[model samples]
Target: MFHLLEKRIAETFASCIGSLYGLTVEVQTEQPKHSSFGEVAVPAAFQLARQLKKAPKAIAAELLSAVGPIEGVAAAEVAGNGYLNLRLDRGYYGAGLLAGESAESRMSAEKIIVEHTNINPNKAAHIGHLRNAILGDTFVRMMRAAGGTVEVQNYIDNTGVQVADVVVAFRHLEKRTPAEVCALVAGPARFDYVCWDLYTKISSYYEEHPDATAWRQETLHAIEAGEGVEAELAHLISDAIVVAHLNTMWRLNIVYDVLPRESEILHLKFWAAAFELLKERNAIYLETEGKNKGCWVMPGSAFRESSGDDESKVIVRSNGTVTYVGKDIAYQLWKFGLLGKDFYYRKWHTYPNGHEVWASTGQPRNSSPSFGHGSRVYNVIDSRQSYLQDVVVAGLRALGYEEQAANSIHFNYEMVALSPGTCVELGLELSEEDKSRPYVEVSGRKGLGVKADDLIDKLIEKALEEVTSRHPEEPEDARRRVATQIAVGALRYFMLKYTRNSVIAFDFAEALSFEGETGPYVQYAAVRARNILRKLEERGERLPDFRAELAREAMARQLAEEDCWQLLLAASKAGSAVERAVRSGEPSHVARYAFQLAQSFSNFYHEYPVLSEANREKKTFLLWMTDYFRAQLEHTLAVLGIEVPEYM
Candidate 1:
């Protein structure tokens, strides 16, 4: 609609007063901040004040008089401040909108891989982990809205220090062997939760009792060597923790097409292949002097530096263990098809959507599709790792693989923290600085964060209370099911609402709210639209064929009459929102858009009677308009990993 309005305004300016400056047309269409401002505001006089050699206000006055009549425009008037205010011909615009029903064909798609939720396979997922998964999944949905090829990948840090810490907890503290651990997993307590408590115990113990660090070192070596009771338990305990993480993310609708393990890449010698390329291309030099003696490093900040100058990241420790950064660079090389290497894959699990999930291993895979040959890769990690990620891109550029480097992106976001009240609820102590800040830090090793399952259960219970109050006669099972949908929506949307850079002081009560600026608010709006459509079907007059942007005057008139142009106008920007999300690797924008769309439609529904309007044509027009908003809102929310319940 703005596109149509822009053309009409531009033609009016260009054909009428625009001839003086010989200007063709380039009228901008931006929504005004307040209803009193205008439907769409443009300031051509400001642009030509110097070129036309006149004051902006005088120029605007001339342009207003010269502004020709457009069919769907009620009037084009110059503001007192030299701004051009264009009010649509409400009746004509509404009627025209209803007449044309075809939507613009969605954008042509592009292939994109979203790598996120690379949580350590060491403990149960906490609120911090939830933030990453929710945002990452929403980003994928936003991309797909514009017909993007999105493949979700969950990176598993099976060989990192965090995993080593958990292994230390099991062996040194729990006194459990691999065979005995299998029995323990069959016990009542969830293994992940058990590990969560044990992990924090180990962390606190090691800080106070220095000898505990030695045990961690031993476990690390045992893990790398893949020998002893430590090796056996490492695989079992690691598998259990990873499963818990997967289950937690699944609650938020975060699914993965691949589970890339850091350990598998090491076992398959993919890093070795990457090393060979580094030596072959002479990109990484073998340092024999000064601080980096015996280490391989690519010299040059040709891009950005992770640390100060003269500092080098050690690929191989003095003891021969590979650093995490080194492993990541190798994995990145394989992703771009640059190392000329491949990892063996076996179908570890099948997704709910029926897609097979393949994991990397050294052994041959009997049933695995081709993976890791993507044209582009997006790594969704937090901003603290910005320096390291920058080096990754630099490493590729040094190897003469600039195109691959260009395609690799670091989709970094801020960490999640707990609100003060939540910290007290979870029974965590905080320091002066922590108290000074707005929220409490969620430390996994300290066991100080909301458990994903417990949060979900609480949300469901709360939602059920509200649902029962609204529809007391509904069956208990049905109510529970609907509550689950709303619960997930509320949780997922809250997680996604904040910008990637903004830190949320996640208040459980604040997040659980169903009214005003919330996920359920959006869900409620969508439900109302759906209900309106359902009621319309019950009536004798069938809805006329309509496009999202209809040219007929009647369609435009109908839209304006509903006083809900706010939703129609905002919904039209979904494409632009999706494009920005993909380009910037942020989905919080989409979440905000979804909320705004739903709120606008909801307010309109509350104020306007769709079925009971005095004018039958007015009622039909409003109902048709509601249907489009409903479809777009539902689709966008789903992309944000939110589910609109049948009732809420």
Candidate 2:
């Protein structure tokens, strides 16, 4: 109701003022801090006073008289100096909310592409990667709720140095043949966990014996050339790890539409096409007289602050090998349909929700769906890659694809660390100094970070302990189901409660709590509302028929009371909160809104006794409000990717 009335009031005033004053104005709104003031406050007269060269007080009086009656507004009055304070008609607003009707659309129908969870296939995903996947999936939910056509892509870096390092480890350190490695991958063994240990071992060897680093370059060349046993070993490692990643993400309800592998980008000659375009447009030139001599470099003047001595970014090395930035530029161009190239596709995996996930292949299948060519692309990566992201956008602009460059976005975020208590809970050894610090940084190279699966298992175990203690009579399988839901909700909400720029120190105790601003707390409020309806049925009384029982005149009479009106008004802002969060590109706003809505419901639940009320009309109104709260809370939780369990 709040989102509906705000748009209706803005449009109505815009139309009214344009006719009377011959001035076009942008409508702005603010919430009144006190209940004595009107619900929606607009300061339009202050904006128009500047153009008319008059005091704002005089302008407010004139516009209020001429604006006429807005559709759902009961009265319009000028507050203090020039603020346009408006009161909503209680019957019309409450009836519309109960009916689940919304105003017209506020967004365009353009298709958007969101790329996230780009975990390297060489190792297991850690706590940091969970943050990226949760943030991306939640944003996708918000965009779809706002009427957007969205396609989710998870880019796999299979041909990078990370994959090559594992291949080198197997061949040199472990002395394994291609057929033997393939057997290990196909056998009943956890291949990804094996690679995770080998990756760290290889990192330590590179520091002590510097000559061993050449093996990385050699393995990379073989992988890029797509020849020899080393290349086959690389493919085996990456494919197994990719499957492991998909399974881990599935536990948290994260699914992708397509997987665009970097190997296909190399095998299909995407970089060659991009290299030709760069040279043709003078986007990159060969460096001659510097430390970066014999390398194709993009001029730093294109992206950096223009100084005569700016450093150039190398795209291709003197050895005729393309750098990671070069491949990234090509991938960005393909997203906008500027490159005259496409990837061959094959179905890879099918999710439990009946959605098929496709993958890019070097060899063509019988038929394929066209991927890429998105109007806008959002790449979810860490903030540490801001420089590379800028270079990719600059490469697009350099090739005269200005619009595509402008549409590309880097949805960057900081890293996740572990709280000191969590580190101790994991049985990790910490020094005295480390224990005193607020958070300990996670290092995948040193095997110091918490694995994603390990954390999820711990949460489930902890939740089950609490669930069984509360409901001992529940069946074991039913208890397990509720525990899984609570664990997922706790993890997702903990990741999203922080802003994008804020670093999170994840703690299990803070996330699983059901008393404060947590997912379980909000979920319990929803369950409480549901139990009210359930208990009424158990007592041989029918639930309120909102359509037939909740008449406009009855609602207006009950809503005239102070507490009833406040709770209804607060519940109506759920949709508006989602719209604000979508526009701001912040999921924390939605998390905060859910917490506030839960808080309001808790207050109303304690104050208003619906079942024992003697008056039928008043009881029906309270029951309807309880149902309204449940619906709004469920909708908001869905947007956050948090599911409410039936029992908890």
Candidate 3:
């Protein structure tokens, strides 16, 4: 409701300014620092001050006079130097809320592809991987909430060096054959966990015996050859690990629409098609000198300004193997339907909710839902890959897909680190130097990070203890379910609260806390609202039909109370919050809004006596407010991929 009103007001101001000054400009609205000033403030007059050669105050007065009345707006006035302040019609807004009016914007016609959680199918997912998935998943939810057609994709690097190293571990170090490895994968052992340890062991082995590094290259070649025991072992490890990854993500309610694997990019000759484009367009040239000699390279000038050094990126090595970025460019082209080549997809997994996830294959399968060919793409990778992402975009531009290149978004985020306190909580021995530091970075090579499943299990165990203490009479199974919900809420919220660029230091206590901006705190606020309604039901009273009981006049009288008005206004802005967050490309904005909304409801709950109010009209208004708050809270939590438990 707020978003619609804000949009209308901005358009009205733009139109008014065009009429008054004969000049066109984009108009933007912001919330005033204090509610007493107004609900929305415009600084268009200041923007026009120099162009008009007049005092901003006079311009503001002129625009205010020229502007006609806006719907849902009570009054507009010029304030300070050049600001236009709008006060909304409280009763009108409140009545609309009572009617269950939707604030959703018009649906976007473009299909948006969000590629995220591209964890290499080598080992167990860690906390850093969790941050990527949660950020990407929440952004997808935000876009969908704003009426965007979004497709969630998880890219699998099944044929990468990470996978090669794991294959080397199984064949060379562990001395296991293809049949033995297959049996191990099919057995009851946690395959990803097993590969995690093997990956670490292989890394140490490489350090001890430098000659063993050749084992990796040999394994890579064999895997690329697409035949032999080595290739079979690679497929077995990656395929099973991918399943483990999906299961881990599903535990947090993160499901994907498709899984695009690197193997398909190779087996289907995607790079071959891309290589021809680069040659035909002169996007890449073979280097003849310097360190990049005998390799196909994209000059630095294509992606970045020259710095007087040979900074060209190698697209293909002298060995005729395409680089990661080379494959990425082809994948990006495929996403925008510019590659001309397409992948054969097969059903891979069906989530419990019946959402199907398809995987790219080398051979044709039965008819399946169309994948890729997106108008826009968002690759949710870490900030470390920004340079590679730039090169990929430059590749598209060089190939004359400038519009597609512009639409290629790199949703980069900082890595997650473990806080010192959390390290101790997890029984990780910290060095004296590390103990003093604020956070300790996790290294997959060193096997020095918390696995996603381990962290989740730990959170649930801790939450279950708290749940049992609070509601000891509840059934053990019920308590466990609620505990799981709280655990997920805590983890997802912890991952989301930080801005994308901000590195999170994961701490269990702070995240799982029942107070102070935590997920459980928000969940408790929603639970409090539900309890109010449940208690009323227990008293043998039915909820009043708010639409019938709360007329415009009654709404105005009830909303006249400053506290009531503020609470209702806050609750009604969830759509506005999501829209703003989507525009800014920051999920933290929505997270911040959720915290503020929860705080507002918490204050309202303490001050208002909804069940015991003597005035019937005011009581109905407060009840409506409670129900509305609960709905908004749950909706926001769902976007964040967090769940509210049946009980606090």
Candidate 4:
């Protein structure tokens, strides 16, 4: 409702300026620095002062008289050199909110593809992978709330060096045959966890004996050739690990529409189709000299400005193997439907909610739902891979898809690190040198990072202790359910609270705290709102019909109080907060808004006693305010991917 008023005011002012000055200008609106001034401030007169050759205050005075009455605005005044301050009609605004007017504008109908959680199918997902998935999933929710169409994609690198290394370990180091490996995957132990330790052992062996790297190269060839025992081993390990990853993500309520694998890209000749286009356009040339001799390389000037010392990026090595970026370029083209190729799709898994996830296959299968051909694409990756993402976009531009190149967004975020205190809590022995640093970076190659399942289990265990202490008479099953909700809320909120570029130092105690700027703090406010409504029912009294009992005159009378007016205003901006967060490409803004809204409700809850008021009309108004706050709190928390527990 607030966003709607702002738009109406901007349009009215833009028309007034055009009629009076015969010149068009875009009008921008902002909130006043102090509430005493007004709700909105406009500086359009300042923007046109030079063109009109007049003082800003005089111009502001003229526009103030020329502009007609706005729907929800009560008065328009000229203040401070040229500013236009507009105060809203509180009675009119509150009435419209009660009538359920929408604040979101309809977005474009074009489909947007968001690809994230591209963890390699080699080891268990760590804390770093959680950040990527949570950020991506929350962004998806925000877009959908604004009425935009979106398709989620999770890319799988099943035939990469990471998977090859694991295959080499099983074949050479562990001496496990195909039959034995299948039994291990079917055993009681977690397959991803078993492979996680094996990956570390193989990495250590490579350091001790340099000659062992040849095993990786040999395994890579067999996997790419799509034949032999090593190829079968790669499939067994990667397929099982992929299932494990999907299960882990499902626990957080994250699901995808498709899984595009590198193995399908290889067998389907996606690179071959892209290679012809690159060669015809001369995007890449064979390097006959220098260190990259006999390799097809893209010149560095295409992606970045040349500094004379810049080196060209190799697209295909001398051994005729396409580099990761080269294959990624093909994948990017397919995303926009520019490449003249398509993948055979098969139903991979059916989630409990009846959502089906499709996977790419080399062989043709039953007809499936349309997968690719997105109007825009966003690749959610880490900040360290920005260079590779740039090269992929450059490939699109060099091949004449200028519009697609512009729309390819690299949604990059910083890595997640662990605080020294967290490392100690996890039972990791820190050296004196490591203890001096503020945070320790996790290394997957060394198996030195916290696993996602382990972290979740620990959080639930702690939350259960709290739940058991507070609700002793409740059933054990009920307490366990609430504990899971609290644990998920803590984990998801901790990953999303920071801005995309800021590094997050994961601390267990800081995240699980029920006080001060934490997920549980925001969640407790929601639970409190629910309790107020529940208490009313428990007292043998039904809720009053707000629309019938509290008319515009009654709302105006009660909202005259400064405190009541402010709380209602804050509760009405949930839609506006989500729209702003989407435009700025930041999910942290929404998280911050949720925290602020929760704080406002807390203040209102302490000051006003809704159930014990003496005046009948005033009691009904306060009850209505409580219900409105409860609705807004739940809506905002849903966008942040956090759930309020039954009790907190």
TM-score leader:
4
Number of colliding residue pairs in each model: 28, 0, 0, 0
TM-score of 1: 0.88
Clashing pairs in 3: none
Model 4 clashing residue pairs (backbone)? none
Candidates' C-alpha lDDT? 0.77, 0.89, 0.91, 0.91
TM-score of candidate 3 versus the correct structure, residues matched by position: 0.96
Q: Summarize candidate 3's per-residue lDDT along 1-648 as a digit string, tens digits.
A: 788788889999999988887898999999988888878999998899999899999999998888988988998898987888999888888987788776667657899999999999999999999999999999999999888999999999988899999999998888999889989989999999999999999999999999999998888888887878888998999999999999999999999999998999999999999999999999999998999889999999999976444878999999988999999999999999888999999999888999999999989877878899999999999998999999999999999999999999999999888899888877888999999998999888888788999989988998999999999999999999999998888888888899999988877677666568888888889899999999999999999998889998899888888888888889889998998899989999998899999999999999998999988988898899999999999999888888888996
Q: Roughly what TM-score does model 2 have, to 2 decimal places?
A: 0.95
Clashes of 1: 28
Per-residue lDDT value at 623 in model 4: 87
| Over 4 Å off, model 2 | 186-189, 307-310, 420-440
> Using TM-score as the measure, what is the rank order of every candidate, best first?
4, 3, 2, 1
lDDT of 1 by residue, 1-648 (tens): 445555566666767655666776576656666766667677778888878788988888888776667766787777756888878766565554444433343445546778988888888887777888888888777777667777888888887788888778777787777777888777888988888888899899898999888887888888877788777888888888877887777777778878888877878787888777777887677777878777777665445444564765566665667778778889898777777878777777776777666777778857667777778889988888987887788778878988889999898888888888878776778777887778877888678888888888899999999999999999999999899889998888888878889888888888788777778888888888888887777886666555533445555555554356655666655555666666666677788888878777877778888788877556656666677688778888878878878876
lDDT of 4 by residue, 1-648 (tens): 999998889999999999999988989999888777878899998998999999999999999999988988988899999999999888888888888886656679999999999999999999999999999999999999888899999999999999999999999999999999999999999999999999999999999999999999889989999999999999999999999999999988899999999999999999999998999999999999888999999998889876342368999999999999999999999999999899989999999989999999998977878888999999999999999999999999999999999999999999998899999998888889989998999888888788998888888889899999999899999999898888888888889889999988888787666568877778999999999999999999999988998888888898888889888888888898899998888999899989999999999999998889989999998888888999999998998888888887
Q: Local error of candidate 1 at 266, Å?
A: 0.8
